[model samples]
Target chain A: MKRLPVNRLSSRTSSAIIWIVLLTLPLWMRAVGSYTELGTQVVVLALAAMALNFLLGFTGTLSFGHAAYFGLGAYGAAMTIKYLVPSTPLAILVGMAAGTIAAMIIGALIVKLRGVYFAMVTIAFGQVFYFITFRWNTVTGGDDGLSGWHRIPLNLGFTTIDIEHDGKAFYYFVLLCFALSVGVMAFLLRSPFGRTLLAIRENERRARFLGIPIERHLWLSFVISCLFASVAGALYALLNNFTDPRALYWGQSGNFVIMAVLGGMRSFWGPLIGAAIFVVLQDYVSSHTENWMSFVGLFFVLVVLFFPRGVLGIIRRRTMR
Target chain B: MTQLILFNVFNGLIVGAFYALMALGLSLILNLSGVINFAHGGFLAIGGYLAYALIPFVGFWGALLIAPFLTAFLGLIVERLLIRRVYGRDPLYSLLLTFGLAYIFEDSTRFIWGAQSVPFQVPDWLMQPLSSDYFFLTGYRLFMVLLVGAAVAGLFLILTRSRLGIRIRAGTLDLETVSVLGVNVRILRTLNFGLGIYLAGLAGVLAAGMLGLSPTIGTSLIMPSFVAIIVGGLGSLPGTLLGGLLIGVASGITTVFAPSATEAIIYVMMGLVLLIRPRGLLGEEGRVQ
Candidate 1:
């Protein structure tokens, strides 16, 4: 009881520190021998992992196929820019809508399932999108990926932010989007819906007996989670200026899940830290060796065996002790 | 046109047989231990590659006999070393562990065998078409079908008649009760994992012969197997087998009409199954949870 105030204070301090670091990342990135693009990637992937944690950590549902929505968002943004309209904001909205709509349908179909079965069905469904992107060569560029499009600069009527040409400006642009998404997520999590989700996660049967509509809540959570994931995916497309079927593959879903797990699924900001570590580690290792898969795999094994609670989890445990 | 459809249906059956083989193994491990063995495909690849390596020394016949056992032995070691620790934890940890193992397996195979597709040889006699009317009906295809049938039959026989098999089935239903009844649940799970991996291995070897042997040979087949499980029913092995065959035939038929949608067809079937029968064709009532 005595530790509660101090705990709250420390958490407040930590979040502030995290924000400071993120705000200063571009300035210090080169000094630390990393580039701005890499920092942008970390934020993008962190959003994805956090989105996944929305369902996995809070709702107690494990979705192993989130990459489908991520990929959908990426393709939606890319195609909107390349084929439909060249407006960046419109592309992001279209991408988000595409992913959310797909999630609505898919979520409805699989909402009744629980645990391992749900994860299995999700993975199987994800492959459908992956196959679509891979085989629809005329539209999607098939295995070559959807290229020849780039993110356009934002026009705020009075001022134009040249995100296309300026890497640092783009990084801040991504960070602003992240901040908005994260703020909304944090707000939603503090609401009654989030509390109900926690209830379901803790004890589904008890929550059901208490008159909560389990399937509806699960479906809504699934959709909301995919909404943010798609947002991240759209940002990811802009960062790269290209999108591929690999973005939607089950393997990518696995990466998102690992990021959530690596950061500490139970905490709000855990996935962000997980994403930063994973993105950096992957970038570094892939650059150094062709056998990077082995290293990544080994890292996963070590994390599962040793650090299953994650970095944030460890810190929390120590503080609690 | 009829011939084309028939050819595809037949082709689909063969592919379905492979899916059933892999899904059955996956289902066994999933049912008993609650671990989705993502590396089941990796095990399949190992089985194929191990057979490929042994073919020179032991000949094709000898490799077929030896390779699955070797793969199963590896499965037992993996279960003992890694998979055993995460037995009763959140399914996420086990899934992640297996997913990692999958990455390592694919990478290791690529490192060892090179990233290029390697030629996996069948006997010249087996390579010949059994009939001119159905050129797809090669001796090797027939042999593969026969062997898969025998393996499936043998698996069922063991499950029904053998002590270990019964224990596995029992463990799948109520592991705690089985454990309390003096069965060493640890050994049961270890052996169960090995049995599952053995099927994966067998499927891998058979697949390498039919498809080009690449590091990703197992990876490509895995999603279909998952579909087979969902379509067939989660808790039922026979259902998984049927699901596998159904999807295979469905895709094969689809190929004649829409070649681009062949891969997507099984998923469509899965969606339909989930809508019509959420528990799958053979899935048990309470096993879904």
Candidate 2:
């Protein structure tokens, strides 16, 4: 405590602050004119954005098709509850498995590609899932979206958590999942494998020369990223109790990417902050006007032009100076 | 059945032509500037709407001639203002910028055009069937094919024969070397982007006649163009053309046996192409890899 490094100290304090804020979000949310659902939405999307940043930020790979996995997870959970079983935990697992399997197959196919080609292929591949869901009207409900399903209440052996009807309880459930995913990600990032990913991201050719199996690592990273994204997706389905093809569209993938960029791809908690801002802004603007797309688009432009390093990136830069 | 198959094949070819036109422009920009230009579809919508707006003031022929030029001008302005700023940055920034531009364009078009499908007019003479036996062959369809053919031929000529074309090719291969050789790489990229947008504009004007004219016309057609590029091979213009036609014909034939799979079939083709030959049917091995 007498001589703690400023960076390390600040980081610890910041993370502590973030946790306290998130933990007490439901308490203060209404006082600030927000609700529990919006807080939950922020947590869900933040998890997604962080998952995306795991690939885009840590691995230095651009994937523009992540919505495919997200949607797959959503549909998996929705369909499980509707057709297979009504267990909430089972639906989440099934959703996660569905997305992971898809990612495994697709990642294998596109891992060899780099740069824009990789991005392009991922986007195109994502559309396959979108079209399948869109055209399979009988099963997927097509353009109308999958409905008539609700998130089942968690039935723990010791006690039951009625997250189904209680908005605050659901927020806590989503928050618990978010914390677990984020903890795992953070642990992974601090490990040697994560260091290797950073090495690859920094200098792929150099890392390749050092005998790092670049493609295999990239594929694994991609799968892991999508796995967590699908977890977020499953929770998203539970949040709304509905899922649609729009969840898997490339445009949604783009939103995930923008969130990562906006939060600062270089930092761990950046996407969480970014997601909060994005979700809140979207809720406010869409409520105010029908031309929200233009505003959102203009925000993207402004961010690209002026805040390319993102909010946290700027803050970090200023502090470093 | 034979007549139906023939009709679908012909219809597919025409659709393929549109894909080729759009893909070629996208390829030109990508090759020269290394930007994917996700806003390419947005430009196509602008071209369609611009043509639709001009038809009453200028005749259909006049609108057809002027609309593309107007769209190209807008493309040039966009390039100069926004796109050029991100040229030297990471490819991610450019992609995000274009994605934003795409959103803006789609939303702005909806705002201006009222979001409903507009009735696009073509000359009555052009809409008439050429013959009762081949009743599917309307004069407008034939004219679209001829005009597209002329445009393709003209583009190839310019690429191969003109100094600007040679510079563009050289630039695509290595812009640094081209820049050192006294060519203005900045102007080259600008013109290349404009050229690409012109093709999109042309496709948009032609498409409005055949399909419903709406803001989403660009969005629906844009994906196939991407498929065309992938099937054709990256960095290969002629390959894009062949890929477009191949998928078009493939999907067209599929319509005869399975109408439901019309849209899905192209994606299947793309998947197969990726599996069999990741480098694409005609893509250079060293290009995308």
Please identify model 2 stretches exceeding 4 Å from their true place: A1-5
Clashing pairs counted in every model: 0, 0
| Model 1 bad stretches (over 4 Å) | A1-3
- Relative to the unseen true structure, what is the Cα RMSD of model 1? 0.8
Native contacts present in each candidate (fraction): 0.84, 0.59
What is model 2's native contact fraction? 0.59
Residue A271 displacement in candidate 2 (angstroms): 1.1
- Please give, for residues B99-194, the per-residue lDDT of candidate 1 as tens digits: 999999999999999999999988899999988988888999899999999999999999999999999999988999999999999999999999
Worst 10 residues of 1 chain A by lDDT: A2-11
Instruction: Give the per-residue lDDT of model 2 (tens digit) for B1-289.
Output: 8999999999999999999999999999988888988899999999999999999999899999999999999999999999999987888898899999998999999999989999999999999999999999999999999999999999999999999999999998999999999999999999999999999999999999998699888888888898899999999999999999898899899999988789889988888888888889999998875
Q: When superposed on Cα atoms, how far off is each prediction in RMSD?
A: 0.8, 1.6
Question: Which number leads on lDDT?
Answer: 1
